[model samples]
Target: MEKFSTHTGIAVPLRQSNVDTDQIIPAVYLKRITKTGFDDALFASWRKNDDFVLNREPYRQGSVLVAGPDFGTGSSREHAVWALRDYGFKVVISSRFADIFRGNSGKQGLLAAQVEQSDVELIWKRIEEEPGTEVTVDLESRTVTVGSLTVPFQIDDYTRWRLTEGLDDIGLTLQHEEDISAYEARRPAWLPRTLPART
Candidate 1:
């Protein structure tokens, strides 16, 4: 996971709503065990249409995605977040997001900002009218700003802290390495160290 502070980049406007994990990275792409190489699978179905926002010039390079309401619905697969990150999306702004997807995004260091529907619409219009215009997401300030428009968003303090510090679940656990080592050293010899090996 990478630290997320302030990001300013072109915003890709995804006008459709109810975008589920299946649409994000089709289930067929889940066979691989590796964490990466899912970028090509992100929005695999939508990419087939040449007119899709992501397939357009400038939008293809966008690192921020401004989507409609009910984004990231259905399924609790963390791969959705991985696909988004692999596709170069640092932040996803929408009016609403599925609870599981939002949680997954936080764990993966991807900022999932929920703004008012009006603000989402404004962002989509701005970016669509002027492709490649930069949008800035300031996690520290909990705000998203585009041109003269600025909107405040809400995020739990813990998740914000984790992302700001680049601490994933493993990273968080590692912080207590010394304590864990001390506990392990105190284990008694009476406890079976390992099960008897089977022939």
Candidate 2:
């Protein structure tokens, strides 16, 4: 996980709606448990066609993705967020997102931004009309600024803190390691252990 306070980069406009987890990383790529190698399999089916927005030169190097409504609306696969992060995308802006997908993304340190449908449409048009159009997403201010419009988005306190500080679930737990160790050391002998049970 990486801190994401502010990001200004080229926005790859994905004009499609109802983009599900299957389309993101595909079921075939789900066999592996590791996170690093999934980038190659991201949008695998679409990649083969060579007509996908991600395959285009200018958008291929983008750090932010602007998509239509109903983004990430399928199975509750955390891998979708991993694949996006593995592909170097930090933020995904859409008019709407599936609840589970949004939660998964936050845990993985990917920002899921919700904007008005009209605002998203405006951004889509702008980016399509001019490739390499950059947008700025400022989490600190909860503002997403395109060329002339700035839209506000809401994020929960815990999720916002996790993303801003790059803290995953493990990272959050590790912060209390000292207390946990002390408690473990103070446990009585009656407490269960990994040793064999008495006959």
Candidate 3:
């Protein structure tokens, strides 16, 4: 996971509500076990239409996505976040997001900023008016800025801290490596050992 202290990039406005996991990566693309290749499958069905927002030239270079309400609404698939991250979206700004999807985003080091609907609309308008305008998402300041406008967004402290430190769940657990080793050394001899077999 990458440290997400601050990101400034072109914002792509995906002006649709109730965007579910299937629409994000589609079920067909879910067969793969690896994470890197999903970029092509992100919004796979929607990209068939040449006029889709992501298919446009400047928007294709966007690293941030500003979406409508109820974003990532169906299923608890973490793949949705994978697809977004693989597609080069570091942050997604929305008025509302599915709880599971938001959690998945945090775990995957993707920033899901929840802001007021007015602010979301404003961001969409600004990006539409100026196609290549840059938007800045500052995790430390908890704000999103575009042009002269800056709006505060909400994110839980723990998630923010994890992202700031680039700590995934495994990385967090490894922080106590010495303590874990110390504890294992003191285990009873009668207890079954859990060491891996040599190949």
Best by lDDT: 3
TM-score ranking from best candidate downward: 3, 1, 2
Please give, for residues 1-199, the per-residue lDDT of candidate 3 as tens digits: 7888999999999999998888998888888888666889899999999999999979999999999999998888788899999889999999999999999999889999999999999999999999989999999999999999999999999999999998869866999999999999999988865676534
lDDT of 2 at 29: 82
Estimate candidate 1's alpha-carbon lDDT, on a 0 to 1 scale: 0.92
Candidate 1 segments exceeding 4 Å error: 171-199
Could you tell which candidate, 2 or 3, scores higher by lDDT?
3
lDDT, ranked from best to worst: 3, 1, 2
- Please give, for residues 1-199, the per-residue lDDT of candidate 2 as tens digits: 7788999988998888999989997888889978667788888899898888888989999989998889999998888998998898989998899999999989888899888889888888888888998889999998888888788877777889888988769867999999999999899989877679665
Off by over 4 Å in 2: 170-199
Residue 195 miss distance in model 3 (angstroms): 20
Deviation from native of the Cα of residue 9 in model 2, angstroms: 1.2
Give per-residue lDDT, candidate 2, residue 1: 72
Model 1 residue 170 distance off true place after TM-score fit, in angstroms: 3.6
lDDT of candidate 3? Answer: 0.92
lDDT of 1 at 147: 97
RMSD of each: 4.1, 4.2, 4.6
Worst 10 residues of 1 by lDDT: 190-199
